[model samples]
Target chain A: MRYFLELAYRGTHYHGWQRQPNGISVQEVLENALSTILREPTALVGSGRTDTGVHAGQQFAHFDTDLTLPDTLIRSLNGMTPSDIAVYDCFPVAPDDHARFTATYRYYQYQLCRRKDPFRADLAYQFVFPLDVPRMNEAAALLLKHTDFESFSKVKTDVKTFNCRIDVAYWEQHPNGDLTFHVRADRFLRGMVRALVGTLLAVGQGRLSVADFGSIIDARDRKRAGRAAPAEGLSLVGVGYPDSVFTQRTTGPAQAF
Target chain B: MRYFLELAYRGTHYHGWQRQPNGISVQEVLENALSTILREPTALVGSGRTDTGVHAGQQFAHFDTDLTLPDTLIRSLNGMTPSDIAVYDCFPVAPDDHARFTATYRYYQYQLCRRKDPFRADLAYQFVFPLDVPRMNEAAALLLKHTDFESFSKVKTDVKTFNCRIDVAYWEQHPNGDLTFHVRADRFLRGMVRALVGTLLAVGQGRLSVADFGSIIDARDRKRAGRAAPAEGLSLVGVGYPDSVFTQRTTGPAQAF
Candidate 1:
């Protein structure tokens, strides 16, 4: 049977979401816990990889096991996992369900705060400059017009193509003078969201005109784009999946367990 | 001149808000940074002291210095301080202004989340048990009826009296299945808010009744009350003072600096 593991992690301490040889990773921690609990070598196929210092509100992974999972599996996994990682739920899924390829849409948000908030210091980027929200939104709207984001993608990435279908892209301003850029796409290239946010911020600051941003996208050169925003400010907010893939969906009543 | 420094800190690292003989404290770090920047030994009188692992959203401290402060003091202090500590603003205040004694009210919040969230791992306490919000509120309302909360105060405290006037006490529920307890009072004894939250949580869990909570307060003995909630879930949200204390209140335009 195949099981889907819904999880979340603060990537500040780990190298990244994927398994790495140099340092500890969220996947390694989860895999170790799974192996210990199942009494066998276990591996996970994660939905996508998040870079170092990038947080996730919700993430999904898939693993296979021949035995039935105990009712207390989630609690046991959470007990074994580090405090920075949380296992929300584990439920049965179709054997063909793929955590990576079956994902329909991905939502990401990058936070920038003008005021210094000690609580959000690690979660948000402290930007001193005032952002022109309207201007930033105008620049963000341009993203939906184009599918090829070669200029925003990191160089030497292993992805097959730079094409991605952007569903929604906009900048939202909060009451506390914080700006958040929300973007949803079918798929994302390495470092694409952060690069787009950084370049759009330049437009908000009036350093780059909207026309210049358009030209940079047309250039298809990573060097033409601004620097990628810091990873700490970025979060994978949601991953959309088809309803048919989940064999069981556990909601509110599960908390009572 | 006396300067009021508004700051905030994530108390996960240091030994709470006050200077201690053993571990490093937020006050000690701030004092060191101030002394280094001003080239004089400076000590701060904080609005209140938070226990270890307790966060502060907005806290005030006062210190005296003879030299004129540069406009870059906030930026310099932030540069010297750790990432967990943020110096929001520094402004001149009246000589008689006191950070601790003159405060009109203090606001504290305790956060509890049923769902596991990695983003809020350090910010909130995770409890999988279902909470009866209405029952918790019923018990919270009883707090406003009494002034001497000897049951909530930590043992062997140096305070002359256990009296406290609770202005507001309520439990707020969020859409994401998180509950936050907000309490405002003229003053708080050491471990008062945490103990109250813990006892209220017991009432919500049906381990104790609302009447039992009132009896616990009437007992006026710390040993009779529930255990104090963990420090990580509690935060000092705000400290209020009179308008006469400030010589100048800096607001939005300071962001440009």
Candidate 2:
């Protein structure tokens, strides 16, 4: 039977979400713990790969096993995994359910701190410049107009198209003067969200106008876009799947051990 | 000139706030950075020490220097310090100003998560237990009634007295089901706040009644109280001092700089 595993991890120490030939990755850590706990070798297919130093508020993966999952499986896996990685839940899924392809929507948040914050240094990008939120949002609306985002996509990739359905794009200014960019789409390219954020920031800084941003998107050239923002500020905040695929609550309610 | 520096640090990497014999400490790091930036030897007297794995939202220390204070001191010190240690501000103070003795209030916050949260795993303690908030508050209210808290003090301390003036004590539950305990006092003994939290949690769990908690304090024995909560969950949130000693704002207002 196939099982879906919901998890979250701080990607600072890991090379990335996917297994790598050189450095350790989140997948290797999860698989090692799952295998050790189950007494059998295990393989996990993640919903998507997050770059090194990025973080995930929520992520999903899938693995198959013949043994019935014990009640203590999640707890045991958490104990074996490193402190930065947390496995929240594991439940059965349909045989053909794909952790990656079955996801309908993806949400990402990029944190930008205007001032120096010791607590947020690892989790946010410290940009010490004034930003025009309204102007940035004006440029944000232009993102949904174009289906092809080659200007924001990574230069080297093996993909048939640079098309993605962007449902939401906006900028929020927090009370602490920090800024957060919220972006939701059906899918994203290799470096799409970071690139988009970088370009929008330029617009907010008055370096580029909304019309210039639109023209850059229409150019369909990576060189026309702004530099990709730092990876540490980006996080995969949410992933949506069909209701039928989730057989049980992703996690149980609070209770005493 | 004597300068009071307001700073914050994530204590996950250092041994603690004070200089230690063997391991690296926050004080050592700050001193090194300040000396390097100022091009002279320096010593800092912190308001107090924090244990290993504990965090500080706002902490203060005083240092003396013969050189004229520069406008770029904050930025230069920040560049010299590690990312986890943030120098927010530095200003001149009265000759006899004390960072520890003159402070009238210190506030601490203890975060307890009812469910698993990967983002907060390092920042909070995951207590998978149902807590009776009202009962915990009842126990918390009892904290301000007494001053001699010898029951919660670490045994080997060299302090003259265990008396503390607790100004505020309360437990607040967030919408996400997380519980946070806020405690403000004129002074605190080593391990006192964590010990109070642990004992109150026992009261919430029904292991100890509110009356039992009061008795534990009355006993004045180190073993009477529950075990001190983990260090990671506790943080020094704020420190208050006389208006006369503060020549400038301890922290600056929110701005995009």
Candidate 3:
């Protein structure tokens, strides 16, 4: 049997999402907790990996088991893990379900604050200066028309190709003067979101012109892009899956919990 | 001679604002950097100690030095420190000037975000559920009416006294849907802001009534308060000082910085 789990974790404590020898990781902890509950060793496949100190609002993982178990695996696994790590959904999925490959889109967000908000200093990047949001947005519109993002892709990434269909990308300001950059893409190259953010920020700071931004994308050269923003300022907000992956009421009103 | 210097530190990665042998601390690293620059052993007296992962927006400290250095020490010191920490103001004060004793008010702000703002996850406590702001504000008003906040003070704190005058206390909602509780008092017992935030969250969560919040303050027992909110959720927003504490204006215009 195969199952999918919807989860979230604080990335600060983990080196990244993957397992490592020197330190405990989010995946290792989850696997240990879930396997203990299932009474079997399980290697869960995660939607993707996030860098150290990078957080996730929503992530998905899949695991297969030969024995039958009740649907309360989420509740049971949660009881075994720390509060910072949470497992909210657990249900059997189709045999062909792939946590990563089958995902429709992945969403990411970055936060920028003008003042160093004491309560949010760790989470939000405090720029302490005005930004050119209009120019950044005009640059953002360029993302929707492109598919190959070699310029924004990290060099030395293990990704097979530097191709991504960015469905949406835009920058919006919140009332508190906090700025948010939301991006959705069919698939993201390693460090893609952070690189895009860094490039956009150059536009925000007025250091890069929109015309230059468009040309950089056209160059298809990693050296042409700006620096990737720090991992702490980025998050893997969510991944969308087709309704057929899991058999729950696809779009019905489920308990909000 | 002794000089009081107002500064701020990003407490992320630091065990706390104080020196500690177990791990890296803001004070220890800062003192080392300053001592290396000043070419003398340096010890600083901060307004108070902040726990590990806590932040200070405007913290005051006094350091004694036998060597005479120009006010440019501020710029030089900041240049040597990392980006996370900086000296916003540096001034020489009277021999009797003290950072802690002369402080008239210490204002703290507790920030809460409704959505999982990846940008603010480290800086704000993200709670998805709606908070009852009006009830929380009412409870905050009740707090302003009291001098003794034994209910909110952390137990086992080494403060000489728990009684303090709260001149300002209230909760306000920002446009980004982040809630901030601004509190100003003559002084705060250790962990008081986090404790108050936890207590107010109980009211906001509808677990405790607004009336019960009033009674909680009157109880004057640490156990009466709710659990202390996470350390990252609270920030030392500002600290007030008398005009005598500031150095004479060397330049023409007078700015807060």
Highest lDDT model number? 1
After TM-score superposition, the amount by which residue B37's alpha carbon in candidate 1 deviates from its true location, in angstroms, is: 1.9
Clashes of each: 0, 0, 3
Residue range B114-142, candidate 1, lDDT tens digits:
86767677789988787889999999999
Candidate 1, A1-257: lDDT as tens digits: 89988888888898889999899999999999999998999999999999988988788899999987888888889999988888888888888999999999989989898867677777889898877889889989999999999999999898888999998999998876788899999999999999999999899999999999999999999999999999989988888899887648675212211
Give the per-residue lDDT of model 2 (tens digit) for A183-248.
Answer: 999999999999999999999999999999999999999999998999989999888899878866
Q: Which ten residues in a row have the lowest lDDT in candidate 3 chain B?
A: B248-257
Ranking by TM-score: 1, 2, 3
Candidate 1 vs 3: which has more lDDT: 1
Better candidate number, 1 or 2, judged by DockQ = 2
TM-score of 3: 0.69
Clashing pairs in 1: none
Model 2 residue B24 lDDT score = 92
**Which ranking of candidates, highest DockQ first?**
2, 1, 3
Q: Residues B50-83, candidate 3: write the lDDT tens digits.
A: 8887777778788988888765677677667766
